[model samples]
Target: TIAAEGGGGWKEYAGGYSDWANYQASVHQAASDKAKVDVRPAARPVAAAAKAKGDKLSWKEQRELEALPERIAALETEQGQLTTLLEDPAIYQRDAKAAQQAAERLAAIDDELMELLERWETLESRAANQG
Candidate 1:
């Protein structure tokens, strides 16, 4: 059973945790879907900025810049997973060495992400300035 208070006052749901979790996920998905429809999606900032500035990049630089976002996203996802693993006390209890490795990876990901973002900014600036 889930009890939540809102503008409509108190409401209760008759379901177990899994059902409530599913309902919550569906509600979030509905909101996200609605937002996607209601909003006018804009081009990615870097791409739009590059286009506006006339895209002075070599084909190689342009491709590298384009691929950076996906690479950054993958690193970020791995970082989040590692962070969650580290946060669980059971992991340390289960395998101290694994926890240490996760911590090291999380730190490495942070550094890598920072470098990628810096590279992105530098590329964006280079594109704008050369245009």
Candidate 2:
């Protein structure tokens, strides 16, 4: 209720309102974390039974592992180029040399990320249990 100034009652006013919002958040804190949740889209591959998984590498895995040398060589080559560019005398000509340095760092991070990806692929292929 509001009284008008003309009435000389109180001259009260009300005109502020926040957004009316209803939100539901479901936070499922994993209990124990011992149970692995496979939420990814792909169905997990079943690894060989514990007994049958002798140290022998599968044909595909052997191929992938053999390819590691080439992949590592490429990653190392890219990293070396990135380092050389960062150290090159002409690269410091930019107005934001600091930013250039940061860019170089980002490049290094990208190279490392690639290396990690390669390693992960290799390891995934070599999984005793491909699950």
Candidate 3:
């Protein structure tokens, strides 16, 4: 005998498996039709504004935007080297003074890197908003 005591055992209560499957299928088809009817085309005013803004950047702003990646890369390389020195056990063991100096330099590099990243993000957001 079919058990109808739990969730999804509604098939037995609905008069059997076939009836339950038909009801679920009809609900799914109706939802799919509603979604298709609600779809919209892209808005034209926003697209035009973005195109116009992209055309309006000053030459210097364009150049700086292009150069930011290379500048960030060089700073990151310097930061990595300083980090290695700070992490080395040999440096700490053989020359405690040098290790401390390396740690201080690493901290300064980290600060500079953070500032550069902030500037880069600001410029990126400005460009996006203008577009």
Candidate 4:
């Protein structure tokens, strides 16, 4: 259906179409920008839990808990060393076996470190809850 009334109807339709397209584009852009943002709340440090009835950790338990950071740091240092070794171009090119071994060792260390961290957190949480 062609409306030929000085092309006013066609101009109005074109103008409306342009406005609608622009509005849709702006909405999509806004949504994309919002999606790019990290909307999750910032994590807070774990608060010390309230003391339980007649619950006290031993001195040894306290000492081990205190030493967690040091142990984690040591493991991190070892991990860094392994990472450096693995990254060496010479090792990758000249000694594939050694590189593979290093990668395996690194993975094992990572697993062990993750386990240790989990255990440490569990113990710490328990201690906090007991205190």
Candidate 5:
């Protein structure tokens, strides 16, 4: 039962390259997903160790931090007195002369406080570096 042109002699077949295409697609996907690894210079041990110890802090650091509170209090004490002096009507009116003198004294104390506070800040910075 063959056709006159021998059409039935050969089985009809599909010419497909789907398997190769699928394999190439998988290979390309794998290439895109490949992990990347890199190496870089390590940090300096001296500087890094210093920074790590600085982060942890220590007994000396605690004392230095405590001094900050004392410095802040001492520096601002004059502000409290100025507030009181400003409020007292007796000193502002009848005691204008005395108030002037007291004001001068308070200014001197303010200057001294500023100097001490600056010194304290410097010391604090040095202590921080020691870590």
Candidate 6:
């Protein structure tokens, strides 16, 4: 069994990562079929927030903060796509290079996501601190 945090909650899959990926794809497909509107939270205005915090962030840092959400979202989308591709057993035989590249990209995405999330949290705290 694989335990994971997903869809704003935690769930345990009965099998391994492939099973979890299949389940997630099915869920996403069903949601898309329903044409459900995605209501994402608004991104904070980094410039204004940084200004309010009185130079807590430099201009470059403010720009980085502003771009974080979109960059994170793009990486997540790519990760999901790579996971789906890797789940197909035929992919290994059909094109080994493609499969290998996908796997490498997925690993890179994982590392990128971790770094971005940590930096985002640190910047958010600095931007929110009154002192």
Q: Runs in model 1 with CA error above 4 Å?
A: 1-55
Positional deviation of 92 in candidate 1, in angstroms?
Answer: 0.4
Q: What TM-score should be assigned to candidate 3?
A: 0.51
Indicate the worst ten consecutive residues by lDDT in candidate 1. Answer: 34-43
Off by over 4 Å in 2: 1-54, 95-131
Summing lDDT over every window of 10 consecutive residues in candidate 3, give the lowest-scoring window. Answer: 8-17
Cα error, candidate 3, residue 118 (Å): 0.9
The alpha-carbon RMSD values of the candidates against the true structure, listed in the order shown, are 13.2, 21.0, 23.6, 21.0, 36.4, 12.9
Ranking by lDDT: 6, 1, 4, 3, 5, 2
Winner on lDDT between 1 and 2 is 1
Instruction: Give lDDT for model 5.
Output: 0.53
- For model 2 the local lDDT of residue 48 reads 38
Residues 1-131 of candidate 3: C-alpha lDDT, one tens digit per residue: 14454675532222346644543465456556545774435435644564666645567767878898898899789878976764454664577577556655665566567766866775677778768
Candidate 4 ranges beyond 4 A from true positions: 1-55
Of the two candidates 3 and 5, the one with more favorable lDDT, higher being better, is 3
In the range 1-131, model 1's lDDT, one tens digit per residue, is: 54465676754443466645554565466556555665434436856776676648878888988999999999999998987886565675688678666766666687679778987887878778877
The global C-alpha lDDT for each of the candidates, from Candidate 1 onward, is: 0.70, 0.46, 0.61, 0.62, 0.53, 0.71
TM-score of each: 0.56, 0.38, 0.51, 0.54, 0.42, 0.57
Give the distance in Å from residue 24's predicted Cα in candidate 1 to where it truly belongs.
36
Rank candidates, TM-score, best first. Answer: 6, 1, 4, 3, 5, 2
How does model 2 fare in lDDT?
Answer: 0.46
Candidate 6 local accuracy as lDDT?
0.71
- Give the CA lDDT, 0 to 100, for residue 33 in model 3: 58
lDDT of 5 at 36: 26
Q: Write the per-residue lDDT of candidate 4 for residues 60-93, one digit (tens) a residue.
A: 6689788988999998999999878754656756
- How much is 130 displaced in model 4, in angstroms? 2.3
The candidate, 5 or 6, that scores higher on TM-score is 6
